[model samples]
Target: MSLVRKFMTVGGATLGSRIFGFARETLMAAALGTGPMADVFYAAFRFPNLFRRLFAEGAFNAAFVPLFSKEIEANGTDGAKRFSEEVFGVLFTVLLLITIVMELSMPLLVRFVIAPGFADDVEKSSLTVRMAMVMFPYLMCMSLTAMMSGMLNSLHHFFAAAVAPIFLNVVMIGALFYALYTGADPLTTAWYLSWGVLVAGILQLAVVYFGVIHAGMSIGLKFPRFTPNVKRLLILAVPAAITGGITQINQLIGQAIASAQEGAISALQYADRIYQLPLGVVGIAVGVVLLPELSRALKGGNLREAGNLQNRSIEFVLFLTIPAAFALWILSDEIIRVLYERGAFHAQNTAVVASILAIYGIGLPAFVLIKALQPGFYAREDTKMPMRFSAIAVTVNCALAITLFPHFGAPGIAVAEATAGWISTVLLFVTLLRRGHLAWDWALARRAALLVVAAAIMGGVLYYLRGVFAASLASGSPLLTKLGALGLLIGVSMIVYFAVAFLIGGADLGMIRRNMKRKASVEPPPPADL
Candidate 1:
């Protein structure tokens, strides 16, 4: 399949999952608002979610997928499955031990890592510990689920793994609905949500587990053993984990700082959910497909092919990311009011969240660009370099957030995160070029400049439309009316952006269409060393 189609397959599924995630967030906003319960629940949830990314998707999947792909190329399906079985045995044992330790240490973990702000309020701190314990087991389930996803992606089976997240959102939505129907207290509803997370983890694992089975690949467990390959995976994964851990540490810093102010953490979480839509669709989808493809290209000594692939993926990301960043910035308040300013969530909360969203939007492109660029390093098995860059980012984030949060609050932390993202992205780009691996040609550079120009034009139009719809977005207006106005602003801005992009020669719809129709004569590749 072509790169465009591969991205679409993953992006389409991600889009569905994000839509469901929106529904879930909307319900949670209505149910818990920016109240104490919402803060506690979100704080607890962030712990396991952090680990799920750091270990599963961040380190394990990154290391395992490349190695597994190489194994398949060197041997075949049977060899890959055997390797997976060995890895699985080790993965399960480690996860089981971690889960037990976390559950047992929930109170201490909550005290230090999750909610230092709740230190004065014993009741709140206790509730947070309980929620964390309930959600802790999710890490184990999702870790295995991520391995299944890596296995499927390596085999060119994107649909099942990509779609599995829908189950998670669906389960949470159902739990919220139950809480609403029963008129449960916000604290009780939080308990419901925590349980929902655990159940969804199981469902997510099951969905991908069945896909692995259907692929005619088996990865059954045996006694834990660290073979040479497993040890290599561990070495690769450790540096990658530190790299991934930097982002989580930044998040924890933000959350800890935000926790000092009641409702700030919840506010930040809501904004994150909004920005994640485009990030998930473009950045994540492209990164997922790009890594293995680049790995294979480089392995086979197809330097030009790898360079072209990198350029095209960057183009795809910028075309989507730039406009998204502009729209989110211009319509931040309207979008927030329309999507979340009802029930217990009020206009004041909307203002705070919107401010954070706009700041986050400014860095959206960098976030997406980092996703496209990192695979260049990962594909070459250069984990240590990215780890060093990430360390720099973490330093920037920690320093700025700590220094600024006292005066600027959550938006300050948002600024810190965005600043750190650009730092990381620029470092990655410079490293790639200095290493003679990848750099922009003049033609690509010109188009990237044009994309920014086109996005700016769209931003101007959106600013005017925002003024026109100002009254409709007023808090006293009906929700349906606000929704209609916000939708019109977004839809029209999209049209304007695309038209201007084409006229300025920044993009070609016809070229994209042709590319979509064209297929590469290769399947998703196995590892190069293989």
Candidate 2:
């Protein structure tokens, strides 16, 4: 398949999952809102998620993919399969042990991590700790899922891994609905959602396992032995793990500090979820698919192709992300109100979350670009450089959070995040240019600039139309008014953006057409001779 098609496939699946996740969050907001229950649930959920990123997605995948790709390229399929089994054995054992320990010590971990938020409120603090303990085992299941996902991605089997996360949202939403139907209290419902995470993780792992099998690969547990390849993976993974861990630690720090201020953590979490929709759809999809492709190309000395891929990835990101950022900025309040302004989520909650969402919107493109750029370094086996840059970014993030939290509260943390994101993007771009891994193609530059301009036009049109519709709808029609206003605004903005983008040559619609016309233009070379 062409790069665009591959991205669409993965991104389309991810988009489904994100939409379902939105529904899940919406239900949670209606049930719990931004009160103590919401705080405890968000805190509990974040604890396991932080570790999942640190161990599974962050450290292991970065190191494992390149090595696994190399083995498949050099030693063939059987050799790569062997390598996978050994690594899985050790990883499984280690994660199982860690989960037991974490489950046992969940209270202490929560106390240290989110203590400031619960400083005086002993009841909420204790609840958060207990909930976190209930959810801690999710880390083990998701870690294994990540390992399976990496294996499937290496074989270009992106569908199962991409689609597996949808189950998470599905299960969680079902559990929440069940709790509500059963007349459970809000805290009881939150606890059920926490346990649902463990269930979802298990389902995700099973889905990916079957996907691997259908793709003609077998993975199983075997005696754990440290081969030279495993040793190299560990060596590479340690630093990468630290890098990933530190980035999460930075977020944790922000969350911890924000917790001290009432509702700041929950506010930050809501804003983050809004921004994450686009980030997951565009940036992460590109990163996941591009990294292994780039690694394979670089290993084969195809620097020109690698550069072209990098350029295309950047173009693709700009095509989607620029418009998304503008839309989020313009429709921040509408988006928040539509999705989360029901039940306990009041008008004041919407206003505060919308403010943070707009701030994050300004940095959405930067965050996505960071994902696109980092793979260039990772594919070349230079994990340390990105780690160093990440350290600088984290330091900036921490200092800004500390300095701003005293004055702006939760919004201050949002500002700090945006600032850190831009700083990291700048550093990554400069390094890529200096190292000659990427260059400024004037065509790509012109197209990106035009995309921004078109998005601005869309934003302006939507802003004006929202006012017109607001005035047209009377005060008594609250539900219809909000829905009508949002629908008209989105419909007009989309039409304008797409029409302008096509007219101004902001996106390569023609290239996409050609790619579709010639379906077999670039076939895989017989699975790398394995």
Candidate 3:
């Protein structure tokens, strides 16, 4: 399959997951709104998610895939399986220890790290602690799941790993539906959601575990030994972990700050969920496929192929994400209202969330670009530079969020996050260019500039159409009417963006076809003769 097709396979699955995520969040908005319970639940949930992103997904995606691919190249499937077993054993043992410690320290973690804002609110803080303890073990399940996913991706089995996340959204949606049907109060609903998260984690792990088995790898437990290879993996992973989860780390910090205000955490989270659709679909798909593809290309010493991969990936990101960013920015109010302004979610909540969503839109491209660019360093096993960049970005985020939150409220932190994102992206792109790892493509540059113009045109059209359709999107509108109006706005925006882009020579269908048809030279060659 072509590289673009591989991306589509993963992206398509992610789109499904994100769609389910929208449903889950919509139900959540109706059930909990931006109330205290919403704040408590999201705050508790973000802690385990932070660790999963910071450790499991980040470390394994940046470190394990490359190493596993090398193992396949040098020693074949048998050797790769052995390596996976060793890593799995060690990962399992360590995760168990971490979970135990975190559970015991739940109170301090909730009071200080997760939501210091909740510290004074005895009820909120206590609920956050209890719920966090319930969900923290999810970290262990998902970490193990990430390792298996890395194995599957290295073996060129992308569907299983890519599809696994849908289960989490599905299970949670089920929980939400059950809660609503029973007319459960927000506190009871929050507890149900916490347990649902843990259950979903287990289900996700099972799905990927079977996927690994089906992909012709039967990994098993072994004694947890820090072999020379394991030690090397850690050396690479420790830095990659920090570099990979920079966004999450920044958001966790923002969450801590946002927690100081009631409903701020949930508002940020609602806005986050809206933008995450594009980020998850485009950014995540690129990161997952690019790292392994780049690793194989570099390992085979195909510098030209590696450069083409990087350039084309950026082109793809710009083409999709720029328009998406514009749509999110221009249609934020309509989108939020259509999706969440129902039940307990008020128009006032919609206004705040929409403002935050618009700022996130400004950073969406940068966020996706960061994902596209990082694989350049990770494929070469140069993780520390990105870690250093992450530190700078986090520091910038912290400083700005602190300075702005007192005056601007929740949207202030969104600005900080967006500014930090662009800064991080520039650092990654420039470093890669200076090192001659990322070649400047005139085509990419021209198209990126034009794509922005096309997106601007789309944004203008959306701005006008939104005003025309104002009554349909207003709070008192029927659910179907709101959905129809929002869908029409989005559909028209897509048509305008694509037509304008193609007409202006910003994007070419021919180029897209070629990319989809282009065969990648990144597949592992046969094992070297022993």
Taking every candidate in turn, the Cα RMSD to the unseen true structure, in Å, is 2.5, 3.4, 2.2
In terms of lDDT, the best-performing candidate is: 3
Writing each residue's lDDT as its tens digit, candidate 2 over 1-530 gives: 77777777888899999989898888888888888777778887888888988888877667888888998999999998999999988888888889888888876777777556685788888888888887788888888888888888889999999999999999999998998789878889988988898889889989989998997889889877888888888877766665655446666888888778777777888888888899989887888888888888887777777887788788888888898889989888878887788877888998899999998999899889987888888788778887887888888999999999999888888888888888888998899989999987898899889999999999888888767765533333476677777777878888999899988888667645633342322323334544
Model 2 vs. true fold: TM: 0.93
For all candidates in order, the CA lDDT equals 0.89, 0.82, 0.93
Q: What ranges in model 1 sit over 4 Å off?
A: 509-530
* Candidate number with the higher lDDT (1 or 3): 3
Count clashing residue pairs per candidate.
0, 0, 0
For residues 441-520, could you state the per-residue lDDT of candidate 3 as single tens digits?
Answer: 88779989999999999999999999999999888999999999999998999999999999999999877875787655
Considering only N, C-alpha and C atoms within 3 Å, which residue pairs clash in candidate 1?
Answer: none
Residues forming the 10-long window of minimal summed lDDT in candidate 2 = 515-524
Which scores greater on TM-score, model 2 or model 3? 3
> How displaced is residue 133 in candidate 3, in Å?
0.3
TM-score of each: 0.96, 0.93, 0.98
Candidate 2 displacement at residue 462 in angstroms:
1.4
